[model samples]
Target: MRSKVSIQKLTMSYYLKDRVVTALNGIDLEIADGEFLVVVGLSGCGKTTLLNILAGFIKPTGGEILLDGKPIAQAGLMNRGVVFQEYALFPWRTALQNVEFGLEMKGVDRKNRREIALKYLDLVHLTNFTNIYPHHLSGGMKQRVAVARAYAYEPEFMLMDEPFGALDAQTRESLQALTVEVWQKTRKTIFYVTHNIGEAVYLADRIIVLAGQPGRIYKEIRVDLPRPRDSFDPRYVELERETTRAVRQG
Candidate 1:
């Protein structure tokens, strides 16, 4: 069977005036269905750029990205869902309304949309905040709403670009646990991007480290540790160290 997502010899470059800057250099990867994969790299390492190519937001100058043996041409709702570092919740919309926005776009009816959206809201433990606006919610709450919105649509895959980066350390850890719980319950395939090695190790089924000026796979580490992983575990620390060494080496 084909993988859920596949990248073959993926390359991207941006034209900065007359000089072309290479953002990615020959990236190849495959994500199995329901796999939680994390990518770590320093700033300017093309981690986010790589995700954009997979999500069809940025076209690669070289190579093709395939899903189920077919090349993806442009962005669409059927294949992928994306979340940003900053929670892009609509301030005017209440928590429930923000989640229901995606269903509204899909033409899901009012009654059905409310029912489905509520189920996901409850999954993220945000039922009480349903009637509250984005501004009324805390930073972590907004991200929870964002997660609910993304998952409520029930897309085949998720692309997260540092969704937890903006939160405090304690809040980040709490949300990470929440994310794991939701994933275990829902089995959603996620391509999560982060600079934190510990975050990657704690959440990922596999970790891919990107490195160098022209980003490439510096190291790919398979996390054999079983879930639900603890941040305090020695094995978790070891995995983070291995990925860290790969980054330094690259």
Candidate 2:
């Protein structure tokens, strides 16, 4: 796989009152095209911050980011789609309309937007709920809508910040499966940040662990297990244990 995004000496810091806080320090990494890469670490380890920078939600204080070898100089959502843990859907819009929001912003015509939105809603198995608003859906269903909305844009990179973190175990697992389904279908590059080591191991092609207060890559673990992996399977368990150990000991 070719390198889809590159980060060199990435650093970030900000002032809160009289103190300067460092979020990331001297970070260096590369994300492959069509790869599912997950970042894991303890809280305040800058996992979310890194994802935010990648999503162009924040400007790094130092270093540079390159997308397809070109410097990313501004915050924009052209080819990047983000799924937040909060299920950041429009409360006023129906499921189909929320999915169509991005396309609308991109100036896609109403007719084509509806067609594309419905297709993605079906992909997430929410076609039947397309007419309902966010308040009418369950947490898992709302998240499925968010996932569908993210995929509707056909983004080059899908940036997720603990997207399933807020759901229950069963729902989280279901959405995890749904996420893999979407990724398999679209083959989009995914950069996800999560504190759940199990989720990271289960979903990632490669896992990057960040350590220390000013976060930096401590270890990189690759998952070689077959897809539709069983958590109880020997190889899967081994990798998950290894990843968990890395997090605890990092």
Candidate 3:
């Protein structure tokens, strides 16, 4: 697969009162087109920081990110979509309207945008809840709406930061499967950050472990297990153990 995004010698730091704290140092990575890549580490490892830089939410103090060989800062385009742990849905808007938000921003006509929004809602199995408001939806339902909203705009890269972290165990597992299903269909390059080893094992085509406190890549592990991945399978169990050990040791 072609490299869709590239990171070279990335570094980030910020002042916390009188001290300048480094969040990431000399980090480098490449995400392939249509690949599911997950970043895992202990807290303070800069996983979210890296994802934010890729989403164009923050500029790294040093180095640069490239989208298809062009500097992301110079690209002048909204080519990345992001999903967060919190269901960042509009409380006032119904599910359908919320999904329509990005399309509306893109200057899509009302009728056409509605059609596109509905299609994405259906993709996320939220067609039945189209008119439901965020306040009325359960946590999982709210996240499904968020996922639909992100996909509706057809972005080249999807940046996810612990999107399933807030949910119950069963709900998290359900959404994990839903995420893979959506990815298989859309084939969008996904840059996901999580501390959950099982989640990383299940979702990632490749996993990069970051060491904490001035985060740097400590290890890279590729998952060779077949999908519809069985977590209970021995190979799956072994890989999960290996990843857990890497995270602990890193």
Candidate 4:
């Protein structure tokens, strides 16, 4: 697998009040093309910061991120799609319309974008709810729409920041499965940040734990288990325990 996204000696800092605060320091990582990479850590671990940099929402104070050997900043917003913990869907738009928003921004024709949007909504198993508004949908349904929206434009990378954090246990698990299904089908390189160890173990090809007080990668673990992982399986349980211990130690 070739490296699709590379973080080289990355650093970020800022001032709060009268003192300087470093959010990240000396970080280096490489994400392979179509790899599902999850970042786990405690609060203030710069996980969101790192994702923000990749999304081009913020520039790192030092170092750089490379996408396909080119500066990630140059990749443009169209190449990197982000899904937030909050289902940032438009209240005014129906599920299909929300999914079409990105394509519309990209100048895709109305009829083509609508067809594309419906296809992705169907991909998320929301074919029957395409005309529903966000406020009318359940939390999980809204999130499904958000995911569909992000993928509709066919971005090379998907940056997810705790997208399932707000859902209940059952909903979260279902969304996790849905996410894996989407990843397997689309093969999009994904960077998912979450505090849930089980979620990380279930979804990641690899996991990186970040430590705080100037966050940096503390440990990297690869999940060798087969797909559609069973949480009750002994190996799965042990791996989850191991990842939890790593996060605690971090």
In model 1, what are the clashing residue pairs, if there are any?
A: none
lDDT of each: 0.90, 0.91, 0.93, 0.94
**Model 3: residues >4 Å from true position, as ranges?**
none
lDDT of 1 by residue, 1-250 (tens): 5688888898899999889999999998998989999999998999999988878887899987777667877436457778888999999999999999999988999999999999999999998889999998999999999999999889888989999999999999999999999999989889999999889999999999999589999888999888788767898888888988887888
Among all candidates shown, the one with the greatest lDDT:
4
Per-residue alpha-carbon lDDT of model 4 for 1-250, expressed as tens digits? 6689999999999877899889999999999999999999999999999999899998999998899889988888899889999998989999999999999999999999989999999999999999998999999999999999999999999999999999999999999999999999999999999999999999999999999979999999999999999999998998899899988998
Model 1 lDDT, full chain set: 0.90
Superposition TM-score, candidate 1 onto the true structure: 0.97
Give stretches of model 1 more than 4 Å off: none
Q: Estimate each model's TM-score.
A: 0.97, 0.97, 0.98, 0.98
Per-residue error (Å), model 3, residue 120: 0.5
- The model with the greater lDDT, 2 or 4, is 4
Q: Give candidate 2 regions above 4 Å deviation.
A: none
Residue runs of model 4 more than 4 Å from their true location after superposition:
none
Clashing pairs in 2: none
lDDT tens per residue, model 2, 131-240: 99999999999999998888888888899999999999999999998898889999999999999988988899999999968888999999998887788988888888
Residue 249's C-alpha lDDT in candidate 4?
93
What is model 3's C-alpha RMSD? Answer: 1.0
